[model samples]
Target: MLFKESFSMAFTALLANKMRSLLTMLGIIIGVGAVIAMVSVGMGVKSDVVNSISSLGSNMLIVSPGSTNRGGVRGAAGSRTNLKYDDAKAIKEKIKNIDFVSPSVSRSYQIVYGNQNWNSSVMGVTPEYMSIRSLEVSTGSFVSESDNNKRNRVAVIGSTVATNLFGTTNPVGQNIRVNNQPFKVIGVLESKGQSSMGQDQDDVVIVPLTTAMERLMAMDYVSSVNIQVSDANKMDQVQEDIEVLLRQRHKIIGGKEDDFNVRNMTSLMETMSQTTTMLTILLGSIAGISLVVGGIGIMNIMMVSVTERTREIGIRKALGATFQNIMMQFLIESVVIGVIGGIIGIGMGCGLSMLVGKFGNFTTVITPLPVLVSFSFSVGIGLFFGIYPARKAAKLDPIEALRYE
Candidate 1:
C-alpha cells in the first residue's frame, strides 16, 4: 500500500509539470531515435556490399598479373604482361574442381552507330565469361567459340551502352564502329544496374578474347583471368592450387616472388562484412553519447525536484513515511519518463527509416534488435541516474527540511 501511494504521488508530480517532464525526456528520445536510424543505415550498406559481391558469381576467384621489377625498380601491380590466354587454358585443363575459366582484356573506345556515339569500355572475353560474371543475353546470342577462333568482328553490348548508342532501336545484327573499326552487334546484355562501388555494370561492350588481343588492341597478353569453382567448400583449396600451378608454370622457385596474384571473392566478402560491422558499431556508439547526456539530464532534474520537495519530504517523514518510500517515488518518476520517451523514440526511428528508404538513394533496413537494445538502454540510464537524487531526498532531515523556506 505504501509503494502504491508513492507511485501515485510520483505520477501526480509528473502530470503537474507536463512541459518540464516532456523537456526532460527530449534528450532520450533523440538519442534512441538516432541510434536506431544510424544502425539501420549501416546494416543496409553491409547487405548491399555482400549482395554485390555475390552477384559477381558463385565460388569465384580472379587472377591478375603481379608487379614487375625492371632495372631494379618495381612497377605497379598488373604492369607485368605475364597473364596469358594459355595460363587460363592450362588452369581449365590441369586443375580439378574448376567450373569455368574466362580470360579477359579491356580498353575504352568510342562506339559509333550512325551519328550517335558514346565512349564506353570494351572487354574481350570467351563465351564462358558470361556464366562466370552472371551476365545474361537479353537478345540474340553471346560470343561463340567460332567467333573467338575465327577472330570475328562481332560485339555484345551492355544495356547502358545500348541505350546511349542505339536508343530504342534493336542493335542486334546492326553494324557499328569501335574506334573506327567496323563490327557487327551479336547481342545486347540485360541491365545490371550499379555495383556496390557505384560503378555502372552495364556500361561496356564484350567481344571475343582473340579478336581483342590480335585485331583491336593488338596485345598478346590478357589483363586478368576469372575462374569459378564447381564447389563452394573447395574455394580456398582451389585458390591455393591455382597459386601453386602458376608458380610452377612461371618457373618461380625457392621463395621467389610470384608473377601472378590470386584473389578469392569469398575472402573479399568476409573482409567487407567485418568492415561494415565495425562501421555499424561505430555509428551506434556515437549516437549512444546522447543517451548519456539524457541520463545526466534526468539526474539533474531529479536533484532539483528533491530540493523543491524538501518540505514535502519533512511532512511525509512526520506522517511516518520511510526513507525507502521517498526513494521509490523519485525512482518511479525518472523510470516513467524514460519508458515513455523510449516508446516515442522507437516510433520516430521507424518513421524516419521508412521516409529515408522512400526518398533516399540508399536503403534502410530496420531490425528489431536495435529497437530492443535502445529501449533497454534508455530504461537502464534512467534507473542509474535516479539513484543519487533519490538517496539525497530520502536522507533529508525532517527538522531541517521543515525549517527551510
Candidate 2:
C-alpha cells in the first residue's frame, strides 16, 4: 500500500541520518521546555496572589482616604485625618449587613523585651479586628473594650514578633516597651503569611486604637478602617450603605467626590483574577511562537530530503505514482517529525514543570486544557509550514528529475 511505502521510506531516511534527525529535534525540545517552565512559574505566581488576597478576609471592606495607587487600601501614609472612631462605631451600629468594624492605626518603632530591641510594625485596632481579619490568638485574648476605654497599656504580639522578642517563654503578662512606653503582652497572634503587597503580616504587634491614639502616638487620626459584611452575596449593598453613611456623616455637599473611599473585597479579588488570566494568555501566546519556529525547522529539512531523493521521486512517478502519492509521502515525513517531537516535548514539559515547582517552592498546576491546546497548536504548525515544500516535491517532472546529475 502507499502508506506502507511511505513509512518504509521514512524509516530508511530517519535511520540513514540519525545525528541530523536528533539535531533537528533539539529546537522543539528547547521550545517546549521553555513553554512549560514559564507557564509553571506563572501558575505559581497566580496561586500566591490568590492566597495573599484571601488572607485579608473575604467579607471585609477597606476604607482609605486618598487617590492614586494608595487609594482604597490600608497603610495610607500621608492622607488627611478624615476617618475617626465615630465612623467605625456608626458603620457597626447602623449598617445592617456589617458584622464588625475595626479602625486601623499603625506605626513602626523599636520594641524591647529585656535587653533586646527590634524595629517592627505595630498596629492599634478594635477587638472585632481579630474576628474580621481572622487573627487567632495563640495565648491570652485580643484587646478588650475595657482596655480600649481605659487606654490600657497592653499589646498582642504576632507569632514572629513574639519569637523575636521573647523566645520559648510565655509572653502573656510580660512587659515589652514600644518607643520607651511599657505595654504588657496580652496575647500572641497566630502566623499569617505575606499580604498581597508583599508585607509580612506575622511581623506585627497589635494594641487598642484608643490607647495608641491617646497614649502612644498622641494623635486622634486613624490610618484606615476594616469593615466586615454579614453575607458575601450582599457585599455591594453593604459597600453602598457604608458609602452613603460615611458621606452623610462627613457632611459632604452634593456632587462633590467623597473624601473617604470604601473598597469591596470580592471586587478586588475578581479584578486580580481577571488581570492574571489576561497575563497568562499573553505569555502563552508568545511562547507558542517557538513551536512555530520548531515546525519550520522540520519543513526545511524535509525540503532538502526531497532534493536529494529526486531519483527516487522520478522512479515512483514513472512507475504510476500519482501527484497525491508524492505529496502524501513528503507530508507524512514532516508530520511524523512533528508528532514525535510533540510527544517528547510534552514529557520534557511535565518533568521540567515539576523541577521548577520544587525549586521555586510554589504551586504549579499542570491543567489538561493547556497541554491539549499546546499540542494541537504544534501539530497545526507542522502542517501549515509543510505545505509549500510538499507541493514543490509533488510537482517534479519525471524526465528531468531522473536525469539530474
Candidate 3:
C-alpha cells in the first residue's frame, strides 16, 4: 500500500510538469534508437557476407600461382605462369577426398550479338567447373568434354550477359562473337548476383578450357585451379595433400619455397565472421555513448526537480511520511521517464532500420536481443542517475524546508 501511494505521488508530480518530464526523456529516446539502428546494419552486413561466401561452394579450395622475386623485385601472386592445366589434372588424378577440379583461364572480352555489344569477363573452364562453382544452367548444357577436347567455338553466357545481348530472346543455340571470333551459345547460367567483393558473378561467359587456351588467350598456363573437396572435415588433409603433390611435381626440393598458394574457403568464412562481429560491437559502442549522456540529463533534471519540491517534502515529512517514502517517490518518477523513453525509442529504431534498408539499398535486421538490451540499459541508467537526487531530497531538514519560499 505504501509503495502504491509513493508511485501515485510520483505520477502526480510528473503530470504537474509535463514539458519538463518530456524534455528529460528525449535524450534516452535518441540514444536507444541510434544504438538499435547501427547494430541492425552491422548484423545485416555479416549475414550478406556469409551468404555470398556460401554461394561460392562448400568445402572449396583455390590454388593460385605464387609471386616471383626477380632481381629483388617481387611481383604479385598470379604474376608467375607457374600453374598449368597439367598440374590441375595431376591433383584430380592423385589426390584423395577431392570431388572435382577445374583449371581456369580468364580474360575480359567484347561480346557482340546482332547489333548489341557488351564487354564482360570470359572464363575458360571444363564441364566439371559447373558443379564445383555451384553454377546451374537455365537452358541448354554447359561445355561438354567433347567441346573441350575438340576446342569447339562454343560458349555459355551468364544471366547478365544474356540480358545485355539477347534481351527477351533466348540466347541458347545462338552464335555470339567473342573478341570478334564467332562462337555458338550452348547455355545460359542462372543468376548468381554480385559477390562479397562487389564483383558481378553473373556478368561473364564460360568457354571450353581448350578453346580459351588455344584460341582466346593463346596461353598454355592456367590462372588458377579451383577444387571442391568431398567432405568438409577432410579439407585440411586435402589441402596438405595438394600442396605436397604440387611441390613434388614442380620439383621444389631441399626447403625451397612453393611456387603456388593454396586458400581454404572455410577458413576465410570464419575470419570474415569474426571481423564482422568486431565491427558490429565497435558501431554499437559508439552509439551507446548517447545513453550515458542521456543518464546525465536525467540526473540534472531530477536535481532541479528536488529543489523545486523542497517545501512539498517538508509538508510530507510533517504529515508522518518517512525518508524512504520521500526517496521512493522521486526514484519512481525518474524510472517512469526511462521506461517510456525506451518504448518510444524501440519503435523509432525499428522504423529507422526499415527505412535505411529500403532507401540505402542495404540490409537491416532488427533482432529482439538488441531491443531488450537497450530497454534494460535505459532502466539501469535511470536507477543510477536517480540515486543522488533522491538521497538529497530525503536528507532535507523539515524545519528549513518549511521555512523556504
lDDT of each: 0.91, 0.82, 0.91
Give the winner by TM-score: 1 or 3: 3
Error of 1 at 216 (Å): 1.5
Clash-forming residue pairs, model 3: none
The clash count of every prediction, one per candidate, is 0, 0, 0
Which segments of candidate 1 are over 4 A away from where they belong?
Answer: 2-9, 67-79, 351-360, 397-400
Candidate 1 per-residue lDDT, tens place, 1-405, comes to 277886788789999889989999998999999999899989989988998998888789999898333247677544569888899999999999998999999989999999999999999999999899898999989999999999999999999999998889999999999989999999999988888788899999999999999999988899999999999899999999999999989899997778888889989999999999999999999998999999999999999899998998898888887888888889998998899889998998889877887888777889999999999999999999999999999899998999877
Alpha-carbon RMSD to native, per candidate: 2.6, 3.4, 2.1
lDDT tens readout by residue for model 2, 214-236:
89988877888898888999998
After superposition, candidate 2 runs with Cα above 4 Å error: 2-11, 67-79, 318-324, 347-365
Ordered by TM-score, highest first, the candidates read 3, 1, 2
Weakest lDDT window of 10 consecutive positions for candidate 1: 67-76
lDDT of 3 by residue, 254-286 (tens): 877888889999999999999998998888889
